[model samples]
Target: MSDSDKAFFTRASELIELANKQNQNKEVKTGEISASFMYAVARYNAWFGSTSFETKEQMQTHKQEMMEYYVERYKEMLEANMNDYIEHFDHYRKTQK
Candidate 1:
């Protein structure tokens, strides 16, 4: 792999770690935001790493297709995380109220 690829992987791993830490905390909103941002960053990295198109138009088309696939996968993972967060928060809130 290239240095750029290694750098991107390192950054992505750090972001994933941050998201994991957030997942262990009490704040659902914070965790959701962190996870969402991580997903976006990973998707961006994948696009950067995978594209072979040289022209602007071709790059845009490739990016769009990749982004669509990313979004679909991200949505499923995000939904699961959000649901778990919501359930935990709701249970905690009930104890407080």
Candidate 2:
């Protein structure tokens, strides 16, 4: 992996750690929200780095298109993951109850 890839992974790991900490503290909602945001941002950055384009103008256009795509996809992923996370937390709560 490139340096950028390593950096992305490091950041993503840190975010996951933060989420785990939140969950351990019984802050399920906050943890999920934070994780979703961090995941979206990290995913976007990773995708942006992976794309290739020649010429400044082409790169700029691609970036714009990618930004839009990432925004929509990230939102969807965030919602789905957040729902899953919340559901998992609820299950834990029920077990404890």
Candidate 3:
């Protein structure tokens, strides 16, 4: 991975660790936690994109374009992570103990 990739993963790892901590609370369902995380991300992305544009009209005009960009990027990352987990299932399970 390039330095940028390393930095990205480092930040991602920190967020995942926070989520894992929440998972440790037996009362919390993983699906609910995942949904909340996704919602928060979507909200933040909308805010970030809004700030990038000078006007609400401009932001509204590019809303679909921005959403598509994020969705595609998320799909790519999700697929990559799913494949990685599938490939290292045993190793991850061992470490989880």
Candidate 4:
């Protein structure tokens, strides 16, 4: 992988590691954890996008485009991951050390 891609994956892996730690607490269901994760991503993305534009009008104009972009990217990622899991169900299901 290119250095940029490696760095991107490294950051993503760190977040996943943090989420896995949170999952170790049995009181929190996986669905709840994932929902919270998605909420944080949405919240952060909104705030991050807002910082780029100086006016509410400009942000409003681009909001739909921004939402569409994120939704499409998410759908693609989810499908890819789902396929990967389905293809490697046995390996993925096995407990990792």
Model 4: lowest-lDDT 10 consecutive positions: 88-97
- Residue lDDT tens for model 1, 10-92: 98689768776776677577657766887777976776746666677776767778778778977997798788878798786
**lDDT value for candidate 3?**
0.95
Give Cα-based local distance difference scores for all models.
0.76, 0.74, 0.95, 0.93
**Model 3 pairs in collision:** none
lDDT of 3 by residue, 1-97 (tens): 8999999989999999999999999999999899989999999999999999899999999999999999999999999999999999999989988
How does each model score on TM-score? 0.42, 0.45, 0.90, 0.94
Off by over 4 Å in 1: 1-43, 46-50, 90-97
Q: Which stretches of candidate 3 lie over 4 Å from their true place?
A: none
**By lDDT, who's the top model here?**
3
For candidate 1, the C-alpha RMSD (Å) to the true structure equals: 8.4
lDDT of 2: 0.74
Which of the two candidates, 3 or 4, achieves a greater lDDT against the reference? 3
Over the full model, what C-alpha lDDT does candidate 1 score relative to the true structure?
A: 0.76
At residue 15, give the lDDT of candidate 3. Answer: 92
What lDDT score is found at residue 13 in candidate 2?
A: 90
- For candidate 3, give the lDDT of residue 83: 99
